[model samples]
Target: MIIGIVGGILQGMEAVYLCKHAGYTSLVIDKNPKAPAMYLADRSETCDVLKEPERAKQIFSECDAVLPAVEDLEVLEFLDSAMKEVGKPFLFDLESYRTSCSKEKSNELMARLGTPIPQPWPECGFPIIVKPSSQSGSIGVSAVKNEEQRLRALEKVAKLNDTPIQQEFVSGKSVSIEVIGNGKTAKAYVTTEVVLDSNYDCKQVVCSSNILPEKDDKEFVEIGKALGEGIGLKALMDVEAIYTKKGLRVLEIDARIPSQTPACICAATGINLLEELVCSKLGKESGKVRKDGCAIYEHYVIRGSALYTCGEKEFSHVEAPEYIKDFWGADEAITDFKTGKYEWRATVIFTGKDYQDAVHKKKQFIKNAMDNCELEEYIDRTPEMV
Candidate 1:
C-alpha cells in the first residue's frame, strides 16, 4: 500500500518509519524541501497543500490513503477536504482535533466524563503547571511555585495570544496510550512510559509489559476508550497521563499521530498502529497479536566532545537523517551521524525479552556511541519536578 503523509517533521518521520516496518510505501509531502522525513520516505514531494490544493489532491490520488502529520488547523482542514474530493480515506478527525487543541475544552470534557486530571489552580495551591490552552508539546508551559511565577507564566501565555490553564503540578511516571475509533467505538493499544528531558519535553519512550501494574494498566486503557468514544473520534489519538500514587491523572489529549511512543510500541509489540488504523478503515482486522517484549527508544545529540541525551524538540532539528540498522550497537536508529562530524543527532531503538534485558542493552548502546566517538562525557538531564 502507498500511504501519503503530509508535513514531514517529527510526526512525518514516525509515519514513514512505521510504513517501512509495515512494508508499505511512504510518500511524504512538505513545503520545506529539506524536511527530515523527506529523506526517509520511499517517495517525496515538496508542495504546500494549502497553497496548491489541486496539486496536493493529485498527489494523494495515487496513494491508498492520506495521513496528515501536521497540527495546523488550516492545513489539516485543507487536506481533509482535498482527500474527500479525491475519494481517498483521510486519516484524521477535524472535530476531535479542534476539541483536543484547546486544553480548556478537553479538560472540561474529561471532567464531565470523570477522568482524573490535575486539580485547577488556586484550589490546588502552589507549585502548579501553567501553560497555554492551545499550544502543543512544552511550548509556553511553566511550572510555577508561587503567585509571582504564576503571573509570569500567565504573561507568557498571553504573549502567545492564548488562554492559560493552571493546574496542580502532578508528579509521577509519565505514561501514554493510543486509541483508534470509528466515531462509534474505540480500542486502546499498548501503554508506554514517557521519559522527559529537563525542559519537560519527551526524550525517550520505554515500552514493556510492566509500564504499569496490571490493574492500573487496565484502567489506563479504559480511560483511553472513554475519551476516544466521548469525543466520537474517527481516526487516531493519544492520551498522556501521570501515573501517581493517587492513580492516573490525564495531562492532555492529542487527536493526531504521535511520534516516539508508537515507534517504541511497534518495536516491543508486533502490532502496528498505522496498519491497524488502515485495516479498521477498510472494515478488516490486522490480526496481529501483542507479544511479551520490551523496547527502549531514546534520542541523543553529539556536540563537540560530549554526548547529550536530548528531547524530541531538539531532535526535530535533525537534517537529512538516514535509517540505519544495527546503529552504534543498537537494533536500529534514525540518525544524521557521519564519521568525523563534530555534531550529529540520532534516535536509537533497541528491544529485549524483558525490562532488565532492555535496560542492559540501552546502557551498552550508549557506551558504544560514547566509545566509538571517543566522547569525553555522557550527559542525561531530567526535569526538576517531574
Candidate 2:
C-alpha cells in the first residue's frame, strides 16, 4: 500500500511511523528536501503544498490513502476537498481541525457540552497562561504571573498574528489521549503520559495503565470521545490536558496526526492510531488488539560526526539492533560531507509493566549503546519546532 503523507516536518513524522507499521510504503511530500520523514519514507517529493495543491493532489491520487500531516489552514482546506476529489481515503478530520484550529471556538463549544477546560482568566485570575488561540505546541505561549506579564503576553500573541487566549494555568501533570473518529462517532483508544524535558518539549511518552489516575480514566475517555464527537471529528486526533487536584482539564486538541503520542500508544498497547484510521477508511474492520505493558519511546543523535554512528553515512544514522525492539521516525542525516556536523535521529521503544521497569530497561539499553556510540540528549531542532 502506498500511503501519501502530505508533510515532512517533525509533526508529519508520526504519520510515517503509522504507515510503516501497517506494512505500507510512504510517499512523503514536503517543501523541504531535507525533511526528517522524507529520509524515512519509501519515496519523497518536494513541493509547497499550500502553493501548488493541485500538484500535490495529482501525486496523492496514486496512493491508496492520504494523510495530511500539515497544520496550515490553506493546506488542510485543500486536502479536505482534494481527498474527495481524488476519491481516496484521507485520514483527516477537517471538522475537528476546524474546531481545533480555533481555541476560542472549541473552548466555547466544549463549555456548552460541559467539558472541563481551563477557564478564561480574570475569572480564574493569574498565574494564567496567555497564548495564541490557533497555535499548537508552545508557539507564542506564555505563563503570566502578574499583570505586567499578562500585558506582554497578550501583545506577543497579537504580534504573531494569532488570537489571544488567556487561560487559567492549571498546575499539574500533563497527559494526552489519541482518538479516532468517523464524524458520527469516536473512540479514545489510548492515552500517554507526557514527559516534557527542561525546555518544555516532550522528551518521552510513557504509555501504560497508569497514564491517568484510575478515577480520572473514565472521565478522561468520556471527555475525549465527547470532544471528538462535539467537533464532528472524521479521523485521528489528540486531546491534551493537565491532571490537576480535581481531574484532567482539557487544555487543547489537535485534529491531525500527532507526533509523539501515537508511537507511544503503538509501542505499549499495540494500538496503532494510523492503522485504525486507514483501516476504517478502507471500510475494513480493524480487529482490536492490545497488550498490558508500559512503553518508553526515546531517540539519540550526536551533532558532531557521522563516523561515530552506525547507519549508512549518506542517510539517517539508524541501526536495528536486537536490543532495540522497534524503530519509529528515525531519519538519516543530510550531511555536507565537507563539514563534520550531522544528526542521527532514531527512536527506540522500551516496554515493561511499570514506569520504573521501563526506565530501567531504557537505562540499561542506553548504557550499552552509549559506549560504542557518541549519543547526546535529543533536542527539537525542527524549523517549525512548536
Candidate 3:
C-alpha cells in the first residue's frame, strides 16, 4: 500500500513514520525542500500542493490515500476536489472538513449547534484576540485592547491579506485536548495544560506544556465530540479550551494535529496519534490507540534575539520534537543556569507508578526548566474583566 503525505512539518514526519510502521510505503510532497519530513520519506517531490495541484496529483498516481500534515485550507480544498476526481480515500468529507478549517464558519456552526463559545466581537472586551479564520502558527494574531487596538488588528489582517476572526479573550489556564475520531465514534487522549513563564504571557508565547487530566473532562469531551460530529470531522483534532466563570469554553479547534502534539500530549500519554490516523484511513478498526499509563512534560528555553542570518531567503529550523539534541551551529552547547543564542526546550516522558506521580513529575519538569531560562517581553493581552 502507498500513502501520500501532505505538508512537511513535525506532524507530516510523524505521519509518514506511522504509515511506514503500519506496512505502507509513503510518498511526501512539499513546497519547501528542507522540510524535515522530506528527509524521512520513501520519495520526496518538490512541488507546491496549492499552486500545482495537478502536478502533485501526477506525482502520487499510485497513492491509495492522501493525508494532510500542514494548515493550508486552500490546499486541503484542492486536495479534496482532486481526490474526488481520481476516486481515492480523501479521509475528510468535503463539507465537514471545510467547516472546521474556517474560523468564521466553525464559529457560526458552533453557535447554531448550541455549543458554548465566546461572543465573536472585539467590542465585547478590551484586548481581545483577533486572528485569521484560516491561519495557524500565531500568524496575524493580535490582542485588541480598544477601538484603536481593533483598528490596528484590522490593518494587520489586511496586511496578511486574509479575512480574520475576532474572539473575546478568555483569561485563565489554557489546555489542549487531543481527540481521535473516524467522523463517528471518537476517543480523547490526556488533556495537557500549558503554563507560560512570568515574563512571557500565557496567551502569547507558549512556554511549557504537560499531560494533566481536566477537572471537567465530561464537559470538554461532550463539546469536542459534538464539534467533530457536527462537521463530520475525522482523524486528529486538538481543541484549545479555557476555564472561565461560565464554564470551560473552547477558544478554537484545529482539525489537524497541533504544533504541540509531539511534545505535550504524546509525552504524557503513550497514545500515538499518527499511527491511529493511518489505521483509520485504511478502514482498519483495530482499536489501536492506547493511554493506559503515560506521563510527560515539554518545555522550550526561549531567548530574545535579532535575526542572525545573511540572506533574503526564508529560514526555518526543525527541533527534535520536544528535546534538545543539537543546535544549528555545531559549536553551541545548551548549558544549565545559562541563556545563550539557543534555549533548552525538551519534552520529558516518564511512566508513573500512579496518577499522583505523573502530576508531580509534570510540576517538577516545569520548575527545573524555568530555573534555567528567563522570559523577556511578551505579547501581553490586558482584557477588561466582564
Best by lDDT: 1
List the candidate 1 regions with Cα displacement exceeding 4 Å. 382-386
Candidate 2, overall lDDT? Answer: 0.73
Residue 171 in model 1: shift from native, Å? Answer: 0.8
lDDT of 3 by residue, 48-109 (tens): 97788788877666688777776666777888788878787765555655676677888888
- Which candidate order results from sorting by lDDT in descending order? 1, 2, 3
Clash statistics: count for each candidate: 0, 4, 3
lDDT, model 1, position 48:
87
Model 1 lDDT, full chain set:
0.93
Arrange candidates by TM-score, descending. Answer: 1, 2, 3
Angstrom error of the Cα, residue 43, model 2: value is 2.1
